[model samples]
Target chain A: MTSPPPPSGHIARNARLGIVLFVVYVIIYAGFVALAAFAPSVMAREIAGVNVAIVYGLALIVLALVLAIVYMLLCRDDADRAEDVAR
Target chain B: MTYHASSIAVAVFVFFVGIVLGISFYLGSRARSAKGYFAAHGQIGWFVNGVAFAGDYLSAASFLGICGMIAFYGYDGFLYSIGYLAGWIVALFVIAEPIKRLGKYTFADALNAKFNSRGIQVAAAISTLVVSVFYLIPQMVGAGALCTPLLGLPHWAGVVIVGVVVLMIVVTAGMVSTTWVQFIKGSLLVIFCAILTVAILARGFRVTADRASIKPVAATQPSDIPFGGQVVSIGNGDNAVGASTGPLGPVQFLQKINDVRVVQWTAKADAAHPGTTLYTPVEKQAREYMLPGGSSTFKGVRSPKLTDKLDFISLMIALFAGTASLPHILIRYYTVKDAVSARKSTVVGIASIGFFYILTLFLGLGAMTSGRLDPTPAGSNMAAPLLAKTFGELPFALISAIAFTTVLGTVSGLIMAASGAVAHDLMENVFKHHPNENAKVGAAKWTALCVGIVAMALGTLFKDFNVTFLVGWAFNVAASANLPALVMLLFWKRTTKSGITAAIWVGMLSSLAWLLLSGPAYVNIYKLDATRAIAPFSQPGLVTIPLGFIVLVIVSLMTREHAKPH
Candidate 1:
């Protein structure tokens, strides 16, 4: 017999979460790019012993990992619940 | 300025290649079936697959190009690091699970899963080959770049060496061996770069004496300098001072850099000589050196011209959208068991890749002040290796070997993707062949051999061309061609097979057309006046990516009534 397809409820829920997180990130990243392109002088200003350009660049890298982990955890819980309901 | 062949470097490089070949042979028996050859039988653990993502994604450009750019131009190179890492956010959050659930072997498998359209099979398979070949050229060029400095070999020998080694790896066990090779290289690259970063932090910066004496030389080429060619100089005249800042923390290093005066070089057409260029030194605050606009690549950001600003934005958008659409990266999702494994592995990839990008800032700045830069145009690609040489011969040897593996891992991945496109998508699906699993495997091996040879030839032919623009073209085309079709197919129920096919062809061709007729291509590739170019700017993503989405939407609406219900 053919195996059953994955529950659409779980898939839909995960896509929803993924889109929300992705939208959130795009806004933040757009801000970084805009500042560097249009208002570079502002990015050159020093803050906390480092320039804002360096600060914002490093923060974007860290924030990607942070959001990725959050999505993985949230999706894991949803997958587990869907599995239990299927059984 | 000169490279000598060292016995230690050769020994280390040989040992690395030997181990890679050994693993490929060891795994050769496990991949006899078609599934095993393409997707490792979906048996690889999430962790191995995750690091393999890092290995596959961080090509020679990420390691050597970014470091060299930063060594010469300061903070401008870090912009690439930021853009490259941010693309992973799109990959993990949006593309991972759907791709894993849909695809069995290749990216076309996922795009064709719903309709089983012959048109899609042809379009996507062709797109995969085009993107893969474009991406492969730079890695081959990188191999030549490394070989000249580390192994003292000619450019053609480097390309051939990498081509043959990757062929053996892919032809032996396909994805099974390719994944493991990527894993080992990824792990070693990260660990050693972390070690190098620590050394940079410990050494800190020192204000050295000015070395501004001009040596007169015969100037025949446009890039040849008439005078004043030092990479960096500190202070001027009697005010020059020599001091050391000892060991400083990462933040402290930036702050110290702002407090010094650094001399940077600018090239201009010589008034005295018609065809030759003159290099002149300009003194500026170290703070300006630590900011953007220090290099020509990023000078657009500070330019008042509207096209210049649009070009920068266009490139950033392409980079952000490209990573998720790459065929090699997409095919990697099938190596794991399920969608959950894909998600987890992507998280691991983002973590490893993100951390390495953060370290690039330190690596680049460290090379900037390392006082060992090669000032020639070719020397920019050698920044990281030359920096390692300053530490000692062993670090240099180890770093060079890791860099070589970097080329091997990326090239093998590209060949695997290309082979899958030919054997599985084109031969079986599009051409209506009824081959058994073993025959399919054999066909894929032959295809890999052919693709590897083609990559070597292109690498040797394009030896003198700037590889940076070739990589940018790959990203722009991949984003435009694949991203619109894949994203729309997954989300919009009205997306017709005709729409997907139309979008792929439009996106791919438009981006390619725009790149070839653009200003940069006019100057660099055609040897013509850039002002007369047809395209408004160099980068095409700002126009073409949106055009892909619009074409898909319009075509789907037009073909909606006749589409079969899923």
Candidate 2:
């Protein structure tokens, strides 16, 4: 019962953009998870006395940051409007 | 028993807490209004709020637990960082704007905006308290851990000190003080960790293996019948030490520190027998850490069983989903001016948090090969701090202080959150009692004190558990109880007040149920001589997260006709 008012086409459009971004996130993350499973040998490497998981783990952090930035872009308008109302 | 560096660290930490509490006392004067106490009069800037998000989010778990995990467990520990960062996606996409638009103060405000139903209030309030307590446990535990090296106190004293300090922080100014504390700590944490990382890279890895001789234990008992045979008394003195007397007798344990070799050890079973020792070379330290392209590697790329896959998958799900659900983190959005700033701040947070996580991978890997690891499970948490100490005692002292501040900032934020729930959601909203913001602020202050005390008690109670492992349980509960209701409320049209309330109850109960019934909690908490557990696995995210969504959907469907558009 407490859902916010529906967005104009703009909000829907933004949500759609979000869906696209989520799909991209899924693909990238899935690929990594799969690699961690099926071809660990090919993926594994030693750098600075640390193992492959550490390297890939670093990449995941970068991925999350980039995705977060992407998310901000996708939802900027709806978020702006919501902020205006909140103020 | 004492050193100047450790003393200085404790003094600095105490000084920092004093400054924060002073600000809270000052803010307490102005927080007479509900808006002033709960939302900072809705006046905080996006940047401050964003930094506060970091301050609130990077609790003891993120700083101490993750770092310690990496320090001891190698790459397996860093997987947590990946999971935590992934959760921001849910915050950005699903929860951010809706939460800002719908309600005024607590999460209950958002959930009950549509129906004005008391049920929603009670359920959401209870969930908030439960999740807050769970989250509180790790922070208190972390506080205790920090105190040992910093103040030369037992773990329980640290918990008590933090609880008292946090109570003061919450009682004095509510969100105003909490926000600034988080902002300062967040900036300090990021900058210091960056500096530490740079130091690690510049110094690089080195071999520092040390060996000690073990006292051989006599296999036979001493008796008059034995001639020219050895009688094994407790062997006591080592170098300049005193004699030891114990049930196991005087058995000397030897620890070899081989800094050059990053030996990842696993206990393997003998094919023909039940118990044995099998040592294999996981990888060389130099080759593992310093790949030609600059990356580290782990052996178990593809875990064989469904349980392995689920463990990995469930951890990821919790980390990604848990961020948006955390009570303290969500409150930061309220402190900001508008949704645009919230988005922008989140972007900044992502950048800072992301960068630090990358550094943790290096930090963890560095500790793994430093030969400073505490081989005993009980001592694993010391790996990171000890690694810093290995570089220099001052750095260790500094990092330990920062880590303690990390706990302080987060615990204060959480107390602020819980106090808001009691003062704003239940007292103000449910009871229909109007307290001027000042009166409400007073209520919030008292609530913070009570909650802080409870948290201290729980922290002392659960002191033996690993701080990192305890945090995972907190995440699991938050993700289950909070995330499903939040996402469905924002996106699904058919979601009714009844549906939201049901989701909160079911999601919370089921996850807590699964966790309590699972092997880890049973063995760890219950102290029962039980058999292997009923569930396929212990962690509940794989089961309970989906269950939350399912309950929300089904309840929404059942109550669709009753649902009204807000």
Q: Per-residue lDDT of B320-415 in model 2, one digit per residue for the tens?
A: 778889888888878876666666778777777777777676566556655455433334555566667767877787788788888889998888
lDDT of candidate 1 at residue B397, scale 0 to 100: 96
Q: lDDT of candidate 1 vs native?
A: 0.84
Task: Please report the TM-score between candidate 2 and the true structure.
Answer: 0.84
Best prediction by lDDT: 1
Model 1 deviation from native, Cα RMSD in Å: 3.3
Q: How close is chain B to the truth by TM-score, in each candidate? A: 0.93, 0.84
Q: Lowest summed lDDT over 10 consecutive residues: which window, candidate 2 chain B?
A: B249-258
Model 1 CA deviation exceeding 4 Å by range: A1-7, A77-87, B211-242, B263-284
